[model samples]
Target: MSEGVSIFAVGDPAGAQLNAAIRRTLFVLGEERSEVWNGVLQAANALRWRRMTQPQPRQFQTQQPLIDDIVRQAKRLRNLVSDGALLDLIAEAAVAVGETDSPAGAVLLQSIEEVGTDGCVVVASKAAARAGLASWLDEIGATVLVPSELDTVASTAETSYVVAPPSFMPSSVVTAPMTPEVTFVMPAWFGNRSLPSSAFGGHAEGQIVIKSTVHTIGDTTEPETAVAEGKEVADVYFPQPVWGTRSSGEREPTSDEVEACKVLLAGGLGLWLDDGDRIRSLDPKQPEGARVGYEAVKGIVPGTYLVLRQGETERGAMYDRAVIALGARARGILATQARWKARLDERLQLIGSRRAMTELERLGVRSSGQVRAWADPRLICPQRDADFALLLDWIGEPSHPTYGNAITLRRAVYKASADLRKELESAVGRADLRALERDGILHLDLPREGFRGMIVARVLAKAPFTEIVSRHHVRVPFTDGSAQWLD
Candidate 1:
């Protein structure tokens, strides 16, 4: 909401901007010469943590095609990014767990079971804590993120498995077994899709969730015509058997279609959609009549199209990105507002309007944000105290959190590079220092004694902002008569 605060500003957080994060790892490795530097790194990582938690889309995602009756739809990979990275390993480094040799590591993969991909990355612990000659770091009992949080799609897939390192070999232990409820299989994406909830065998708990954008009030969602107006777009694949036929007849879900199959708006509510962008209702139900919570209205994707009348389109793509970035923060407001609106409407239907207005105003909660910020736990919730918490979780907020990076970059640099590379990195990055070097006021120097005792040796320094820009160094034994140091 501030100036220069657009999605583009999110910038690659994994870049040099994250130097502080790297330093924190270093500090944990027993490298500490400056406590002041540690404090700075702490704040920097906190900031990075925020942005890392924002609900951005996958950086690497392919299309989804599981329409064939033979190619039963399994869990998608795009939704795995939130699961964290997988551990990198080699066969030699493998260890045994619980008295078993060649211990197969486990992972906690999270996702919606069907949309996009999860970027929960697979990573090898760089830590030196090894069990033995067996690359101890790799062989230890650890939880690896299958797809890595770097991946956005893999985390949201319906069912995640605690797969072993090798793809072919079956592990002795798997989080999800071959049981019916353990494995989910959804219907086809397009072409006369029809199911009776009995079609998915026993795993009928799957529901296709969708966040549609609305234009007009009512329209048809027939796939036969180019602009088939649908008063509602029904993702009826969930809790029921339904088929969707395409206009051209060539069909394969891009990604969202497959995920939507596992979700159903509550009470058989229907959504109007043409290209996944919600239009309005078709079953002749008032806005107050529809369902509530994430089961009813999920969050929209990044590039959803609206008003596809062969010309203009909805510019909500930015809103989509912001919503994704703010994640549950934005969704919390929507869900709470929807639930509260339903409650208010119900109250109004029974009581006088004047009294309702007075009650809401008395609580200092005239808007959705106020409702979202309600820590009181005693608000007019539809259910119990955790109603607010549950609503936040549905929207991906009040649970997982992340923060902006650029605002914290400076602080991180100050922490990690108290006087090391960051200080020099900034020294080189700054215009004034660069000018000083050119004008002979400052010169990069490598002490004749090397890093053990080195200085920038100011020649004609004039900037009075020296409090933040000073230099110091220390050294420790490295090898025979040699040493390593950072200033």
Candidate 2:
């Protein structure tokens, strides 16, 4: 127990974009490969296993099965409103839309304004009757502004925008064409000129020039330009507020009472056999190296990513053993788990020939998770080595060293064969490998109906995961990129 609590302020494990970018950039930095590393892994073992595995009823996710769950429900609400169920629900809520002019549409407008609402913008076509729309807007207590027909909206436009880096007291993105009409709510300290000329700013044709900035946190703001030229657009965003006190390692711990807390870590908090079965508590001494591993594990979940929790030291993070393999797999402890998703995304120009991807999309699989389930797809789809590689190349590199390299189909085959042969050398090993393969692994084969299908990719690494496998009943169809540890 150090005298005082270890109060290293922690922040969210950056978004996939930044994470992917850093991992990809770092790897290429050493090798001088400007090209981005793709984020997919083709799991040979998983594919092979899927082929021979028996059908077992898989559990269905009960919470929400698809990303469109909300959208679908919202659409249902529209129908319900017409059918007359909406008036009944809203009648009891004590709220009115457009009042003398409230319509269900106006009600939806209000509902969408709440924090954390999956937001959408409503644009009405010209003949859509302004009176009814205004009636709807008034019912919803919304101010109706004439939208520019020629204006466009974009999520990312890096060509000429400059944003304050993520590291700042209050980070902000700058834009051009700042004006008073644009009611943008930004941090209080932010200045009109605080934005550099490079801030990604552009005009919506003849309507107005717009720029945007997101708050560090919570709902607070500094003065902002309400309008530019003539357009009446408001800035939309949630501000994540910052709070927490800082502490140092050297803070007073020499006192007697302070040292007593240290006793709790003596095998009292049960050890976490982190990735590679390295006792996380052992390396408390090297918070630096352990920190790298710490970050890898943390990416798995919010806090358990630690080698050991609280003040416990990491004991044997050096070994190749793992703790809670499948759970970690779900949390992303596998090499695929450690990747920086942003970098691979950059290379993924979304500009390739989509014929093949389109075909898969038509079938249903859209995400890597869904793709993993397509190894042994329905149509006995022939080899997709090259196509899959192209798709993988665009997803960006993950930080875990295990992902992205030569297709490794040939090498994986040889390695798989060798491993099989060696296992057969020890009959016990053969039986075990065969049994596990017969159990199951996942695959994906679609990008479109991904809402309905799967796409396939595989992660192949040589490791005696059976030990970890024995501990958990779940099978994680992925691998830790570290052959040294997993092996």
RMSD to native for every prediction? 30.4, 26.9
TM per prediction: 0.14, 0.16
Which 10-residue window of candidate 1 scores lowest in summed lDDT?
468-477
| Candidate number with greatest TM-score | 2
Q: With candidate 2 superimposed using the best TM-score fit, by how many Å does residue 365's alpha carbon deviate from the native?
A: 42
- Model 2, 10-98: lDDT tens per residue? 11111111122222222323443222111111111111111111011112111111113222333444443332332222221111110
Stretches of candidate 2 off by over 4 Å are 1-198, 202-242, 249-487
Worst 10-residue lDDT window for candidate 2 reads 259-268
- Cα lDDT tens digits, model 1, 343-428, are 43444445433453455455443333233212221122322224434434333433322112211222332332233332333323
Residue 203 of model 2: what lDDT?
Answer: 33
